[model samples]
Target chain A: MKLTIRKDQLNDAIQQVSKASSSRPAIPILGGIKFDVTHQGVTLTASDTDISIQSFIPVENGEFVIAKVERPGSVVLPAKFFVEIVKKLPSDEIEIEVKDHHQTSIRSGSTDIQMVGLDPEEFPVLPTIEESESITVPGDLIKSMIRQTVFAASTSEQTPILTGALWNLSEGQLKFVATDRHRLASRTATVQAENDYKFSNIVISGKTLNELSKLVADDNSEVEIVVTANQVLFKMGNMLFYSRILDGTYPDTSKIIPQNFKTELVLHTKKLMDAIDRAYLMSREEKTNIVRLITQEDGTIEISSSSTELGRVTEQLEVKEFKGESLRIAFNSKYMLDALKVIDSEYLFIGFTGAMSPIIIKPTDHPHSLHLILPYRTTG
Target chain B: MKLTIRKDQLNDAIQQVSKASSSRPAIPILGGIKFDVTHQGVTLTASDTDISIQSFIPVENGEFVIAKVERPGSVVLPAKFFVEIVKKLPSDEIEIEVKDHHQTSIRSGSTDIQMVGLDPEEFPVLPTIEESESITVPGDLIKSMIRQTVFAASTSEQTPILTGALWNLSEGQLKFVATDRHRLASRTATVQAENDYKFSNIVISGKTLNELSKLVADDNSEVEIVVTANQVLFKMGNMLFYSRILDGTYPDTSKIIPQNFKTELVLHTKKLMDAIDRAYLMSREEKTNIVRLITQEDGTIEISSSSTELGRVTEQLEVKEFKGESLRIAFNSKYMLDALKVIDSEYLFIGFTGAMSPIIIKPTDHPHSLHLILPYRTTG
Candidate 1:
């Protein structure tokens, strides 16, 4: 296999596929990135059993000349070192030649690097998924959805399904919900779809979604997501992201969300987040991460937390708007802060259904995003 | 104690003094920052036994209004939490009041944080050094000298004195030298001194110098260096940095640096450094970190490194100038790279005594800085 490619193009392709490569793989070939060169262009693929990514660089596309092919062949090289070498190469163009016995030579400028390449036959093939049911969504919206809900997913593996975010599409509205039992976050967006196809239980690992989010372009580019029986594929530009769906049912978090509230408080998002963040420092020391919020009769909220070793912090914020009855509630400050950060609005509306029930938070302008945090029982 | 200080001023003072506060201090009070508020200004001090730093914020200094003293008193507050609180405070000016029972209340905007303060009497006093024998030097020069020589200090604690850089002053010239047996780096500079005072065998820990380098202002401000029986104090601007001297005799490294060389190579510092850096990646994986350099008869040099698992890399760079005889030598690429990084010149002149003797590298423009790296005996 022999190919000449632009350094920047090759670096970008390697970075895209290298995300799927594992530092310590169960199979040695999983740690390698497969380079398939053909007359059309070159395709780089990497996989770690759970997540696989493939990036293609066409020989010539309009104004961009990505690569030039001399011979059609394939080989697998150690992803870690190859990526580093490609990034640090001096010349604008790099020439890679693979001789017999999988001996590869990379030359750029005055440097010549010979790397041992593994046989391409040993590397795993990309998983094939049917593109029968696919939904197209804006890359920017999907990235925002992933960022809003992925952090709420449980990191613990005790219940493996909880470590993934549920992707449900119904009636042309795609929803992403993630919960670790303590708190829950959900984001909904309108996606273009043909017919009334519904995907109810497509739960993808939060880790995979986080990686996919990074690949999503910030522009309003369309991303085609194809869901199969066991695998899901996201196609954007010349990149294909594939991940296996979790094998379990996601909990029915909709039932836990409170529909009614005893009190509702509207305040500036940044102000509330800052106050809770400071209170969290004290509560974090106590390990409980519990911060109390008390609503006064004068339409003001008091945020405070105390630790035996670290004294206490008290902050008062004037509510912009208040409704119903005044109430006091205690919840994990980290959960509140996390929920507040994802709300892209100036003002936040928080609804509490009694002190023991779950509290719902939503941006005043963005009703499509919802966050719920369960209150902690406090003796006070 | 009651005082109102600007958030930026308090934050800077806390950051400066907090460097001396250790996370796990031997004495609990040592982890706290002592605040002495007088009619003139407030002095913030922190000590970790080996090193102590104090920063003063004056009440009124022309355009810089650092702090205002409402009442005069002293107290020591936990450095970690106080710094964090000050950074996150909302208002521009923070009001701190120390009540009875060592309780401190810090108010900023609508937030109030109360922290438990330790007794100021329990904190260690700053070491007093007579300024009669002090030398004033530009802060920028001392910072540069520290960066050029500190990395060569031995990290292993087997010989405690080797972990410190030897500071020698003679005839208005200040010299700093550090070596880890295999490699040595020395830097010399002319400084203004009173009389013909000479200081020798004064070794300061490389770690302390590195910390002091961070506190050094980037401008041409003068820094006063005061040396005593067992301590060295660096006074820059309104900050005083005190560090304890290492106790031991530094080995004479002058004899190892050969005056005459069998080979001399002058090339672009960046070009050679880049070639060696690439070779070092392969050698680093082999656990030898040895890169071979061979001077050809045509006045060009070949750099290469090979590993059984990672194959090999070979690069040839054209030498701008070469003298003496052609020679081949192998050395640790990391040491050479470290030395090249600190050279403030585009071209570097390397002097080799022999294949086995130490090689000296110096910038063509800078004669005050010198770097020496020992050769590795390669089987090939």
Candidate 2:
């Protein structure tokens, strides 16, 4: 493969594909990145058995020329060293030529690097998915949804299915749910789909979804997602992101979400976040991470935590509004802080069914997203 | 202790002293910061046996009232948690009050934190150094000199003295030198000192100097350094940094630095640095980090490196001046890069003593600093 590409363009494309390349691959050949140069442009692909990513650079895009292909050929190069070399080359234009026996020479400015390349036939073929069952959603919306719910996914490998986030589509509404048994986060948004097209139990690894979110360029750009029996493909601009779906069934979390509350409070999000954060430091020393919240008769809430060796901390914040009953509850401050950060609202609405029941929280401006945390039992 | 202090002033002082506090200390009280409040202001001190740092915030500094001392008292608070709590307090002014049995209450805005404190008598007292054997130098110049030479110090604990930089004073000149057997760096500067006060064989840990460098506020500000039999104290602004000296005899490195060379080259520092940096990446894979430089008859130098598994890279750069004889030599590229990065000149003068002798590097504009790297013997 012979091609002269712009340094910046090639660097960006290499970085995008390198994300899928694993440092330790079960198959040694899987650690390489496949480079294909054709009359149209150059395409780079990398995979690690679970996820595959491919980025393409056209010969000409608008008034700029990203690359020029003199001969159509293909080769696979070690992804780690190849990317680093390309990034540090000291020239605007780089010329790559693959000679006989897969000997590749890269020249830029006064520097020239010759690297050994593997045969492209050794690489695994990219999976093909039908475009018939596809849904279009804004890139920004999907990224936001993934960030809001992905952190709640279980990181342990004991329950493989819990390591992924479930994607459900029904009645033009798309929802994502992730849970680690202790806490759960759910976010819903509207997407453009066919009336009869609906997908359920499509679980993608939270780690893979987070990588895909970073590839999204802008909020207004549309991302097309196609689902098949075993794999899911996300197409954005000139890049394709593909991942394998988990095999197990996701548990029904809707029943656990409380519908009504015996106590409710609304307060500014930043004010409450700051108060709990301070209390968390003290509780962290005790290894419980438990912070207590008590509603005062004067319409204010007191947050406090104590450690046997570090003493205690108490802070009071005036709530915007309170209803139902004044109660005292203890919960993990880290879980509440994580939920509060992604609410995307000035004021947060917190609902409590009882001292032992799950507490539900949502943004006051929008009710599409919700977070649930289980309160800890304390013998006050 | 009862005091109302500005949040920012207290936070800065805590951070400065916290550096001296160790996470794991031989004595438990060494992990805490001693707070001494008087009618003048509050003095914060922390020590970890090897090093001690103290910061004083006066009652009034210029137009800003840093602290208001209502009563005089003393206490010791855990450095780790204390720094974090003060940084996150949500008020411009923080009030710290010590109740009975050293129970301290820290109040800021509506937040209140009660922390358990240790008795001030348990903390070690700060050492006193005589100002008779002191030298004053610009803080910025000393910091630069430390940066230029400290990286060459040996990090291994095998030779404790090598981990420290040798500080020598003679005829109003201060010199610093560090080496790890393979490479050496030396920097010299003129300081204001008593003509009769001359000391040699004084070595301080590179790690301690690096921490002290960060505390230097301004380049033009004077730093008063007092040297004692076992400790050295540096007073910069209102902060005092004290570190124990390494007790050992430093090897003489002057005998190894060659005065004459068979080949000489003067080139742009940045250009040569970039070329060697690229070659170093290839050599790094071979585990030698060795790059070869060959001077051509046309007054240009070729930099190249090859790996058995990864092929090779070669780059040519034009030299501004070439004299003596054409020669080829090999050396560790990392050492060359480090020396090149610290040189404060546009053109670097590189002197090669032969094929196997040490190479000397210095900036063309200054003769006070020098770097030496030993050559690797290649069979070819």
Interface RMSD of each: 1.1, 1.1
Off by over 4 Å in 2: none
Stretches of model 1 off by over 4 angstroms after superposition: B63-66
Interface RMSD of 1: 1.1
Q: Distance (Å) between predicted and true CA of B31, model 1?
A: 1.2
State the lDDT of candidate 2 residue by residue for A219-238, as single tens digits.
56999999898899999989
CA lDDT, candidate 1, residue A139: 87
Instruction: State each model's CA lDDT, in order.
Output: 0.92, 0.92
DockQ of each: 0.77, 0.81
**Candidate 1 lDDT, tens digit per residue, A1-380?**
89899999899999999999998878768889999999999999999989999999999889788788899899899888888878877789999999988999999999999988899999987788866978999988899999999999999999999999999999999999999999999999989987998899999999999999999987879999999988999999999999999999898988898888889989999999999999998888899999999987777999999988668999999999999988889999999999998899999999998999999999999679999999999897
DockQ for model 2 equals 0.81
Chain A (alone) TM-scores for all candidate structures = 0.97, 0.97
